[model samples]
Target: MNNFYKNYKGIIWLLTGILCGSVAGLALGKKIEVLKPIGDIFLNLLFTAVIPLVFFAISSAIAGLEPGKKLSRIMGVMCLVFLGTVIVAACLTMIAVWLFPVHEQLTGAILTEKVNPQPIGNQITALFTTGEFYELLSRKSMLAMIIFSVIIGFAALRSGEKGTAFTRFLHGGNEVFKQVFIIIMKLGPVGLGAYFAYQVGVFGPQLFGAYARSLGLYYATGAFYFVVIFSVYAFIAGGVKGMQKFWRNNIIPSATAVGTCSSIATIPANMDAAKKIGIPDVIANVTIPLGGTLHKDGSSISSIIKMAVVFALFGKSFNSADVVLLALAMTVLVSVVEGGIPNGGYVGELLFIAAYGFPPEALPPAMIIGTLVDPMATLLNSTGDTVAAMMIARFTEGKGWMENGEYGLESGVTE
Candidate 1:
C-alpha cells in the first residue's frame, strides 16, 4: 500500500485538487473565477515546456536506435494499430448516437466571429512545415517539431562516431526537460483545481444545463469506450494477464490524462506506466510521444459526435449511409489536420465546419460540446497510447515479452 501510494501520489493529489476545486466552484459560483490565473499559470508552464520536451524525447529515442527492422516495423505496426483503434472508437460512437440519438436545441448565442476557412491543402502544408525555424519552437507546430526531431535523430545516428556527442546532447536535454516537467506537475493539484473551479464557476451553467443532454451522450459514450473497449485492447494485447498488468499500472496515467486535458502533458505519466508494465523502451518511447501527436481515439469519437449533433441541430437527418461514411473519413482526415495546430481543440471544430459546409452558427454548439467533452476525450487519447504500446510490444517482442524480466512487478522495473 505504501509503495502504491509512493508510485501514484502525484496523480492522487492532482485528482483531489480537481474534486475540491469542482466542489468549490459549485458552492461559490462566480466568486471563484478569480482563481483562473493559477490554473492558466500551470497550463502555460506545460505549454512552454512541450515543444522542447517533444523534440528531445523523440530525437533521443531515435538517436538511441540502430538500423533494424524492429524500429521500422514498430512504426508500421503503430500506425496500423492507431488507425484501427480510432476507427473502432468512431464506429462505437456512431452506433451509440444512432441508437439513442443526440437531439439538442441550441440555446446559447452562436459564435458571431468571422471565419474565413482556409483550403485543405494549405492547412496540411501549415500542419507539417513552418515558414521559419523559430516557428517550430511553438507548440502549435508540434507535428513539424516532431518531424524535425526525427530528422535530427536519424542524422545523428547516420553520422556514426561524429554524431555521438549530439546524441548525448539530445538525451541530456530529454532528461532535463523531464525533470522540469516533474517540477511543474508538483503544482498540478492547485493549478488544475483552480482551473477546474474557474471553468465550472464561469461556464458550468452553460455546460451543465444548456448542453447537458448532448454532453451526457458524449460522456456516457466516452465512458463506455474508455472502460470497456480499452480493456478489450489490453486483453488482446496479452490476454487475461495483459488486462491485469494494464489496469494495475494505468490508474496514475488515467487520472493524469483527465486532469491535464492535454495528451502531450500526460506523456510523462504514460511513459512511467509503460516502464512498470515492462514495455521495451524502444517501443514505449516511440509510441507514447508519437501517439500524443498522431493518435487520438477520444478525438475521433468526438468527431463523430460533433458531426451527428451538428446535422441533428440543423434539422437534417444524419442517419444516411453517405453521411456516416463521410463522418468516419472526416474524423481521420481532421485528426491528422489538427495535430499540429495550437490548442488543437478549436482547429478540428473549424476544419469540420469548413469541410462539411456547416453554417457559422453551427460552430458555437460544436465548440461547446467539444470543449466540455475534452477531459474524457483527452483521457482516452492519452491512456490509449500506453495500451497501444503494450500491443506494439506484444507484436514486436512476442507474447512472452512481459515475463521476460523486462517487467519486474515487485521492483517496477528490472533496470
Candidate 2:
C-alpha cells in the first residue's frame, strides 16, 4: 500500500480533493460560491506554465531530430499517425451524434448569442501567418507555430556545432518549465478541490446526471473506436504477441491517466513505462512529451461528438461544407494545440460550437458533459502517446545506438 501510494500520490490526492469538495459543496449550501475564486486561481496557475512549456519542449524535440532521411521518415510517420487519428475521431463523433441526440428543450436556458463570429478568411490567414498577428489569434496560430518550430528545428539540425548551444539553451528552458509545472502540480489538490466545489455549488448535483449521460455516450463510442482502430494498428505493428506485450506494460500508465484525468501529470510514469518497453530514451523523451502537448485524439473526439449532439438537439443540421470544414479545422486544432493548453478540450469545444454559430445554451451542459469524459480521453490520449513512441522505436530500430531487443524488448521481437 505504501508503494502504491508512493507511485500514485498525485491521483490519490486529486480524488481525495474531489470527494471532499463534493461533500463540502453539498453541505455548505450558499457558501459554496466562495470556492470559485480559489478554483480560478488554481486554473490560472496551471495555465501559466503551458505556453512556455509547449514552445520549449517542441523546439527541443524538433532540434534533436537528425537532419537527414531519418528525420524526414519520423516526421512523415508522426504526421500520418496524427492525421489518421483525427479522421477516426471525427467519424466517431458523427456516429455518437447520430446515436444519442441531445434534446433541445433540455438545453434551452443555455442558448444565447454572446460570442461575435470571426471571419473565416481571417481565421485562415492567421493560420498561415507569423508574429503578433498569429499570437492574437490563439486558436488558429498553432499551425503557424508548428511551421515555425519545424523550420527552426531543421535549421538547428543542419547547423551542427552552432546548434549545440541553442539546443542546450532550449533544453535548459524545458527543465525550468518542468520544475515550475511540478511546483504548480503540488498545489493541485487544493486547487482541484476548490474548483470541484465551486462547480457543484454553481450547477448543483442535478447537473451530474446530464454529465453522466453524455459521458456514457462518449465512453461507448471511444471504446468502440479504440478497439477497432488501435487494435488494428497494434496488430500491424507487432502482431498479437506484440500488442499484448505493449498493453501489459502500458496498462498502468493508461489507467493512471484515466483515474487522474490529466495527461501532463501522468508523464513521469508514462516515460518510465516507455523505457521499460525497450523504447530508446531519446525517442521516449522526445515523443512522449511532445505527444502530451500535440496529440489529443480523445479530446478532439469528445468535443466533436458533443458538438454534433448539441447541433442535432437544436434541430440545426450542418451542411456538407460545414461538416467538411469542421472536421478539417478540428483535425488541425487537435493535432497541434488541443492538448497543450490547460482545460484545452473544454475551451476548444466551446469555441468550435460558437464558431459555427451554434446556440449558446448548449455550452454549459456540453462543458459539464465533457469533463466526465475527460478521464477516458486522457487514457486514450496517453495510450496513443505510448503507441507512437513504440512505433517510432520500431521504425528507427536499425539506425540508432540501441539495436533491437538490446534495451529489454517486451514484444518478443528478436534483434
Candidate 3:
C-alpha cells in the first residue's frame, strides 16, 4: 500500500486535479477563463525549459556512449526491433482511423492564416538543418534541433580523448536539466488542472465531444495494441515460456509507466524486470536504455491520431495515400527518437504540424490529445521497451535464450 502510493504520487495528484477542474468547468462554464493565466504561466515555464532539456538529454546520451562499450550485434538488432515495432504501431493507428473515423470540422480552422507553404524540397531541407545555429534554439524547429544534437554527439564522439571534458559537460548539463524538468513538472497538477478547466469552459462540450471521440479512439487502439499486439511480440520473442516470464515480471514497469508517465522514469523498473526475466544483461542494458528514447509504440500510435484530428478539423481527407505515408514516416521518425520525459511529445507534435503544413492553431488542441493519452501511451512506450529487449535477445542470443528454466535463472550475464 505504501509502495503503491509512493509509485503513483505524480499521477494521483494530477488526475485528482484534473477531475476537480473538470467539475469546476462544468459548474462555472466560461467563467473559467479566469484560470487561463494560471495554466499559461506553467506552460511558459515548460516551453522555456524543454529546449535545453532536449539538447542535453539527447546529446549527452549519445556523446557518453564510449564507442564500442556495448555497441555490438545487440545494437544492430536493437535498431531493427525498434523500427519494426514502430511501423506496426503506425500501421495499426492508420487502420484504426480508417475503421473508426474521428473527423470533425473545427470552427477555429477558419481563423487560421492563409498557409503559403514552402516548396517540398525547401521544407525537407529545413526539416533537418537550420541555416543558422540560433534557429535550433526554438521549439518550432524541433527536428532541426534534434539533428543538430545528433551531429554534436557524433562530433564529440569522434574527438576521442580530447572530447572527454566536453562529454562530461554534456552529462552535467543533462542531469541539471533533468532536475529542472522534475521541478517544472511538480506544478503539473495545478497547471494542467487549470488548463483543462479553461479548455472545457471555452470549448464547451466539444472538449468532451470531438476531443473525447479522439480520446476514445486512441484509448481503444492503445488497449488493443497493448493486449493483443504485445502478446504477439512476447510470443515471438520466446514462445510460450518467454511470454509467461514477461507477463510475470512486467507489473512494476507497467505501473511505473502509468504512475510516472515517463519512459525515462520507468527504465530502472524496466531493467529490473528484464533482469528477472533472465534477458542477457548486455541485451537488457543496451535495449532498455536505448528504447527509452528510441522506441515508442504509443507515440507512434498517438501521432497518427493527432494528425488525423488536425486533418479532420481542417476538412482534409486523411485517407489520401501521400498524406498517410507522410504521417507514417513522421510517426516512425517520432517513435524512434522521441524524448521520454512527461509531455515530451510536445516536440513530436510540432514536427507533425510542420511536416504536414498544418496551421499553428492545431498544436494546442493536439497537445490536449497528447496529455490525455499520455498515461496509456507511456504504458505502451515504456513496457514496449522491455518487450523489445526480449525480442532483441531472441534474435541475437538465439532460441535457448529462454530454455531450461533459463528465465528463472536471474540475469544471464553476457558481455
Candidate 4:
C-alpha cells in the first residue's frame, strides 16, 4: 500500500482534484457561494509564498555566479536565448491570431469605470512616507529584485573577504528556499485542485462556451509557437538527427511540465533531463533555474495572443505601434521580470494586463482561460528551455569550460 501510494501520488492527487473541481462546478450551478471563499483561501496560500520565494531564489542564483568577466558572457548568452525566443514566440502568436482568429463578444462582460490604480499621489506616498516601500518594490519586485540581486551579488564578489560571509549566507538562503519549494510542490495537487474547483465554481457552466473557444485558440497558438520556434532552433543546433535525439531525451520533462502546468514545479525533472542530455552542470544549474524564473515563452506568447483576441472582440483595433509595444513589453515582463514560483502566473498576468491597460472584467475571464490553457504553455516553455540548453551547449563547445562530446552521450555531436 505504501509503495502504491508512493508510485501513484501525483496521479492520485490529480484525479482527486478533477473530482473536487467537478463537484465545485456543480455546487456553483446550484448557487452555493460558500465554496468561493474556500477557493480564495487556497489561492491566498499559493500567492503568499510567491514574493519571498522569488527574491531568495533569484538573489542567491545571481549572487552565486562565479564573480568574474565570465559572468558577463553567461548573462549575455542567457539574455540572447531569452529574447530571441520571445521574439519568435511573439511573431508566431501574431501569425496564429491573424490566421485563426477567435473573437467572440462576451455577453454580460462586466464593465467597471476605469480608475487609475497607480495614482501620482500613491506613487509619491510610497516613495517618501513608507520606509520599506522602496525595499518592497525593489527587493520583492520581480524585475527590480533580479537587478538588485545581480548588483549586490556582483558587489559581494568585488568586496573580496568583506563580502564572503554575506554571499555564503545568501547561498544558504537560496538552498533553504529550494527546499521550501520542494515542500510547496508537494502541495501542488491540493492547491491546483482548489484553484480549479474555485474557477469552475465561480465561472459555472455559463462561462463554458466562451472560455472553451478562447482556450482552444490559446492552446492552438501555443503549440504552433513551439513547433515553429523550437524546430528552427533544433535544426540550427543539431540538424534532424540532433533534433530527434533532443526530443527523445526531453520527452519526459516536456510531458511532465505539460501535465503539471507549472514550470517552477517541474525544475527537478527538467534538471535531471538536462543532465542526461549532457548539459554541463554549471550551464544547466544556471540556465534551468534562471529559465524557470525568466524564460516564459508559453506564457508570454499566450498573453500576446489573448490580448489581441480580447481587443478584437471588444472592437478595439491597436495600431502597429501598439502591437509592437505590447509584444515587447509582454516578452520582457513575462519572460525576464516574472517570478519563478507556482502562483507567479497570476502576478505576471496581472502585471501584463495592467501594463497593457486591459479592463478588470477581462481579468477574471483571462485568469480562468489562462489557467485552463496552462498545460500547453508549460509544454512550450519546457521545450524551449531544453532547446536553449542544447543551443548553449553547442555554442560553448571548444571553450575550455565545456567539451564537444559532453552533451552528446546518447547521440554523438554532429558537425
Over 227-325, each residue of candidate 1 has an lDDT whose tens digit, in order, gives: 899899998888999898899999999888766667888899999998888887777878899899779898898888887767765656777765677
User: TM-score of predicted model 2?
Assistant: 0.65
| Off by more than 4 A, model 1 | 1-70, 104-210, 405-415
Return the TM-score for each candidate structure: 0.60, 0.65, 0.82, 0.65
State how far residue 319 of model 4 sits from its true place (Å).
Answer: 6.8
Top model number, lDDT: 3
- The C-alpha stretches of model 2 lying farther than 4 A from their native spots are 3-7, 69-78, 102-113, 127-147, 231-328, 331-415
> Please, what are the lDDT tens digits per residue for candidate 4 over residues 336-362?
645554445555655455444454334
lDDT of each: 0.74, 0.63, 0.79, 0.61
Give the C-alpha miss distance for residue 152 in model 3, angstroms: 0.8
lDDT of 2 by residue, 222-307 (tens): 88766676666665556675577577777788777866667887788788887776676756766788688777778767876676
lDDT of 3: 0.79
- The CA lDDT at 232 in model 4 is 76
Q: What are the root-mean-square deviations of the candidates from the true structure over C-alphas?
A: 8.9, 6.8, 4.0, 6.7
298: Cα error in model 4, Å: 2.8
lDDT of 3 by residue, 301-323 (tens): 99999988877766677887667
State which candidate, 2 or 3, has the greater TM-score. 3
Per-residue lDDT, model 1, residue 42, is 71
Task: Flag the better candidate by TM-score, 2 or 4.
Answer: 4
Better of 1 and 3 by TM-score: 3
List, in order, the clash count of every candidate structure. Answer: 0, 3, 0, 1
